[model samples]
Target: MIKNSTKVLVLCALALSLFNCSSDDDNDRGNWIERSVFDGVPRSNVVGFVIDELGYMGTGYDGDDYLVDFWQYNIAGDYWVQKADFPGTERSSATGFALDGLGYLGTGYDGVDELTDFWSYNPGSNSWTQKADFLGGVRQAAIGFGISGTGYIGTGYDGDNDRKDFYKYDPTSDTWSELVGFGGEKRRFGTTFTIGDKVYIGTGVSNGLYKTDFWEFDPSTEVFTSKLDLDEEDDYSITRSNAVGFTVDGLGYIVSGYNGGVLNSTWEYDPGTDEWEDITGLEGYSRQDALAFSTGTRAFVLLGRSGSLYLDDNYELFPQEDYDDED
Candidate 1:
């Protein structure tokens, strides 16, 4: 009887160990490591674009005033260097993209009015030159991306109304033209990330509701193909405006945004599978309007607001690693 009781106790202990291991595996699939804090003032609605190995970020609101100070981040060195101030008016909620080795920024709110001015950044000379104004009129919180040496900007709010139109830019001629065909809803503050030749756009709020419809835009075909809804799965919670979207290791990720309130949730997208999997969220404070930089291989999120509080902290995500609170 004594030996039988001892054997039963040992089996119970083994079962308990297995249960704990399973729980940990289920809860921890990704990790976030805090990196160097942003050198700029804490701000939100900043715009950024990655060019080669460096990332350019600028133009945001620090809760008090609009900002124009521009900064360049070296991904390999993990440091930031102040660049020339944005020559445009102080603004926030602008959109930017990099193409043909040059960066372009335009369309934002400048405290008193919406702006349609566009400018291009020449990294070689470290200067910005005004380009043709956006043809879509003055808007803020629009989405922008570069594909095949051309830049595209679309969908945002004018002073009074939200928009769903898209336009393309030609750097050689410095011209803007409308590129219609997007069937998605009108939204501002939506997120987009490019994978290969296709760009995925989704999230953001329209009519005070978080948008769930996802779409893929192919520059070659100039078509907007609908993907799975963000809420396709019963467990998927991937709709939020002001989130940051980026690609790392050929996978797309959206992290930290507002949906009724600030959120720290992270969702990973597989282009081949058209599916989203929940990953470890931002280990830091939940935020919205943050900036994300991806060097094709590495990605990082930084500088945003949590409610009324502005933040300058940065974090890098390791999607396949086990979660560890300690960096």
Candidate 2:
């Protein structure tokens, strides 16, 4: 019953409405999505490493006690399965690194003492084997990374003091050799991750003050080069410790940690430009001592405390897009 021109105008109006909805969806595409919650006790200072497409997480301290249960998340299936218990003493503030298809964990604080024993996990057999003791002194809250077939560890609290001494482990020889010390101030509970062949380390508490100094370590030359500091005159830049750092699509990101108070701010670092840019933070409550790992195609943040309450919620970050809900 309508005229031809009237019908044309109605069609155009409908098309415009549909286009606007599509644009809104596109804007939220790269945001964080709630994923499967961790299938273990909620805890802080957890560690995670990726082997192929699967991520392994374990060994942290609940408010009541230290824990050693190990779990693996199948990224493709979006579920978690318990793995072999960590063979070391139940502890917290440990570090885990994946190397040559296996995972190595060591250097944590048991309830009674700081620990130096190290162990390696074999994913194929779901078993762990004792490795040479960490060359560094008994310590906790250290950082570890594997690169080009060798494992490196350094910079943690040795119970008596904060440490900067670095060490490298050659699995082929089952030996750890002390390397040059890290360039930054002696620190504990800092975050570390590798992009390409270089390892980046920064952001921690030392002498009652939180740090923002960032450094990149090249294994080939065994040198540490300073990167742009996280603290800036800009108010948006966040400097905190016990955060998680991971690399995705060749870019590195730091997310969620404590700086006097719990924090949820996120920052992206571009190695090409040696700069950092603040981005939308994660959704939900703020937290510290969380764990992050990349499954090549995606990066995940999971399980940390936010005061008296421990959290088991999990989130997947799309660093290329703005976060879904920013606080």
**Model 1 score (lDDT):** 0.93
Model 2 lDDT, residue 221, Cα: 90
Choose the strongest candidate by lDDT.
1
With a 3 Å backbone cut-off (N, CA, C), the pairs that clash in candidate 2 are none
Residues 215-274, candidate 1, lDDT per residue (tens digit)? 999999899999999999999999999999999888999999999899999999999999
Candidate 2: tens digits of C-alpha lDDT, residues 1-327: 469889999999999999988776534324677889846568988777999899999999889989999999998899999999998899988988999999999999888899999999999999999999999979998889999999999998999998888899999999999998567988888888788989999988889888878899999999899887877547645678889998888988889998888988888788899877776677766899988978656999888989978888888888777544442
Whole-model lDDT values for every prediction:
0.93, 0.86
Relative to the true structure, candidate 1 reaches a TM of: 0.94
lDDT of 2 at 244: 91
Backbone clashes, each candidate: 0, 0
Where is model 1 more than 4 Å wrong at Cα? 1-27, 38-40
Candidate 2 weakest ten by summed lDDT: 22-31
TM-score of each: 0.94, 0.88
